[model samples]
Target: KINKGGQLSMKESGEKDKNECHGGDSRFMAMTLKRGRKKKALEYLLKKEESTVKAMVDLKKKYA
Candidate 1:
């Protein structure tokens, strides 16, 4: 943490800082996903939610 004067405490050192950003070794960061996927699943889910709400509003107007 920084002091009110925006200065770091002398006790704060790079040794602890190096440990925090460790995202693991390269093998752990490797991904099996294909590159440039366009998230069609999320788009589909959003469309589903929108249609459901529109449908509910129409039903409420017709039957309420």
Candidate 2:
């Protein structure tokens, strides 16, 4: 298990922060759906979708 803010640098912490953001967004979507805020949830989903797509495109370009 990773230590809590041990010797990791800011870059490492930033990566963890991004992962938490993604996870939190996913949980928020589920909660929004449960509350019948489907539209808002979908909007939030699109932002994630956009970010994922951009990441994928960058990865492809990097390897291709």
Candidate 3:
């Protein structure tokens, strides 16, 4: 789904068996960003040393 800022968002649909639901067991979410933003995110993760599964999510939000 698209959010207020026109960015893609993953809202829970409570469909546990469907990958379309952001809350699927795979725990993977997809988004699109500019190249610079992607590089910045990588730098941020490295500098902060937060590469755990949860931290990667936080990084996504921060860069988004």
Candidate 4:
């Protein structure tokens, strides 16, 4: 945490700052996926979600 003067506290060292803009190691981007690869992954996820929703709808129709 920072003080009102916008400076880190004594217990908060500069190395503890986790902001990616400040050159922190981001675990989220650690995969190193390419742009096209990311697009394909997202499309696959969307298709899976769509199929799950469709199956749920069909199950509801069958029971309700």
Best by lDDT: 2
Q: Tens digit of lDDT per residue, candidate 2, span 25-45?
A: 434444556676757655654
Query: Which regions of candidate 4 are displaced past 4 Å?
Result: 1-48
Candidate 3 per-residue lDDT, tens place, 5-31, comes to: 332333446333343354321133224
lDDT of 2 at 17: 48
Which lDDT value does model 4 have at 2?
47
Instruction: Score candidate 4 by lDDT.
Output: 0.35
Q: Residue 15 deviation, candidate 3, in Å?
A: 44
Cα displacement (angstroms), candidate 4, residue 20, comes to 36
Ranking by TM-score: 2, 3, 4, 1
lDDT of 4 by residue, 1-64 (tens): 4433232333334545333334222221222232334554344334334543354334334433
Residue 49 lDDT (model 3): 27
List pairs with backbone clashes in candidate 4.
none
Please report, as a residue range, the 10-residue window in candidate 4 with the lowest summed lDDT. Answer: 23-32
Candidate 1 all-Cα RMSD: 19.3
Candidate 1 positional error at 35, Å: 51
User: Which residue pairs collide, candidate 2?
Assistant: none
Name the regions of candidate 1 deviating beyond 4 angstroms: 1-48
